[model samples]
Target: MEKIVISESNYQIRKARIVRTKKLTPLETLFEIVLDGDRSLDHEPGQFIMVSLFGIGEAPISVASSPTMRDSFEICVRAVGRVTKALHALDAGDEIGIRGPYGKGFPIRIFEGNDLLIVAGGLGIAPLRSLIQYVLDNRRDFGKAHLLLGCKTPQDILFADELDQWRRRMDVQSEYIVDRAEQDWTGPVGLITTLIPGVHLEPERTFGVVVGPPVMYKFVIKELLAKNIPEHQIILSFERHMKCGMGKCGRCQIQNIYTCQDGPVFRYSAVKHMSEAF
Candidate 1:
């Protein structure tokens, strides 16, 4: 019988070193990493990579930086579980294993020349940050851009400094809200959906990109639909718990579709029929 040899590249783990670390919040820490030989992650906005530690297991983390930043890439980790807690404990100069920048990412070409309505809730901003940064870098390629951000509290907001920079940009329209207000918080107090109603855009030329918790989708999508945006123009990211980045694991399967391979980013019209997608 002939021997069938499998390629190791599919499961190859590259060694990467952390160059910097920033404590975004008490629970979330951001790591700036560079691969061996200064290799760029070269990932698209909304794509994720599997981060591994020797003794501890690996977890899938979305690429938080846009591909425009060629020097290095970033991943924002929240200390929620065993692997993430361990990841949070590491500091700059630490070494880790990196497998891939897997899954489908946001389609930038299709969104070109169209106004963008980007909505992020809580930790969902991590992935959407990639797309936002890309748009900012290539601002001339797109039309009007709007950012609607929601966090639990003032302390829970990630990238505070960058968020302020975004708000200051005359080219971008940015609005924020918090579920509960702290003494220092002077912004609107309510759900993210509340900001959607006041946004002014041409539905035919607007594209709505949303990333957030499962519960946020139902309400947010409803609001987007009410804005008269076409179903095909509404895009979403479903960050499911994918055990293996490849399609073989079946961990991120939504019915027959693999969220890890087929999605994590999907159009509203494409997955609207799938009850589990939202």
Candidate 2:
């Protein structure tokens, strides 16, 4: 018998170190990580990586930083489960394993030269931040950009300072709303869908990209369709428990389609019929 040896496994984990950390919310902490050897994650916006802790296991996290950030990348973790809770305990100087910047990302080439309508809800902003930052970094390549963000409350908002900076930019039109508010709250109070109607864009020239809780999708897509955007131009990132970054795991599967491989990102036209894909 002939011997066939494999040099590497697709599941290989690269050593990465956390260089900085910030507590975004009571539930969420942001980690700034750099791969060993000065390597860039080199990931596209809306893609995700599988982060591992030797004893605790791994979880798929969206790359919160844009590809423009070549030196390091970020992942905003909400300490909701075993792996994430353990991840939150680590601070700067801790080491972890990184498996992938896997799955298809937002199609940047298709978005070029088009007006953009970016809608994010709650934790969805983490992944969408990548696309938002990319568009802003290469601002000239895109047309009018509108950002509509919604959260449970003011304090729950991620990247508050950065969101303010984006709002102040003349090139980007930004609006925010919360589902509920305190006595001091003065901004609009409602579901994120409330903010969509007033946005003015040439639907034919606009691309609508959305990411958020599963419940947010149907309603948001309704509003985007009402705005006359084509189904194919309306993009979505579906949240799934992706056990493996590769398609073989079957954990992130939606029927025959694998969210880890076929998506995390998909055009509405491609997934509208897939009942499992919210």
Candidate 3:
């Protein structure tokens, strides 16, 4: 089978300018950007965009902003490679090239009226942020929502302002977990999976969207299943080494699926049989 091309000739950057760039931690930089024309990114919650650093290279980055915000989009980039490091050096008002709002985003509409359990770890919170914000912007569209966040330490938390907002919201339950803490930190200190047991949910009506390092899912999904969440109801997004945002690069292939094309997001039942997917 061939692949579905999201853009015929790769959409032009259309002049995206950085509105804000923050270094959340030693490894990550958060970019708040607007398409130069101020157009809607028109992305689904879990889809990704291909960002090009001319004369350097391109990489697939998840659109980290909620689709509900039509004017601009965001992506959290971790500096593990050259292109990412170059992106880190850019500042507000600096222009960058972009293509797509591609692949699948979380199935926000399907999970609309249903309860949702969001599990994020490390930089996993980046992509999950889109859905989490969407749910908040349209609180009445979904049932009870619970977010379980885990990171290396207190200083590693992302979207501090947004996390505070979610904490104060009446419709959502939010938990923050850390692997270790200093005296100034006071929160659950453990793996994110520990928070799952305490959430009140009807597994059948709930979808668990888990995003994290590939190593994190096996344990986290096992915990969600033990709590009676159906395998199919478990939603997951994978992190991969992506080259082209278009499927042709073959850099993001995970067995028969291209993490860049077939998914960055997939239902657990769809990949439960594919051990390569985490």
TM-score for each candidate, following the candidate numbering: 0.96, 0.96, 0.95
Off by over 4 Å in 2: 1-10
lDDT of 2 by residue, 133-160 (tens): 9999999999999999999999999999
Candidate 3, 1-278: lDDT as tens digits: 24656666355655588999888778888898988768788888888888888888887788888888887788999997878889998999898888887787788779989999999998889889988888888999999999999998988888888899999988889999999998888787988888888988898999999999888999999999998999989999987888776678788887888887788888999889888675
Which of 1 and 3 is ahead in lDDT?
1
TM-score of 1: 0.96
Stretches > 4 Å off in candidate 3: 1-5, 9-13
For candidate 3, give the lDDT of residue 266. Answer: 89
Off by over 4 Å in 1: 1-10
| CA lDDT of every candidate | 0.91, 0.92, 0.86
Better of 2 and 3 by lDDT: 2
Q: Give residue 19's error in model 3 in angstroms.
A: 2.0
lDDT of 2: 0.92
Q: Write the per-residue lDDT of candidate 1 for residues 1-278, one digit (tens) a residue.
A: 11223247647889999989999999999999999889878889998999999889999999999999998999999999989998888899999999888878898999999999999999999999999999999999999999999999988999999999999999999998999986887889999999999999999999999999899999999999999999999999997888888777898988878888887888999899999887
Q: What's the CA error at residue 60 for candidate 2, in Å?
A: 0.2
Clashes per candidate, residues 3 or more apart or on different chains: 0, 0, 3
Clashing pairs in 1: none
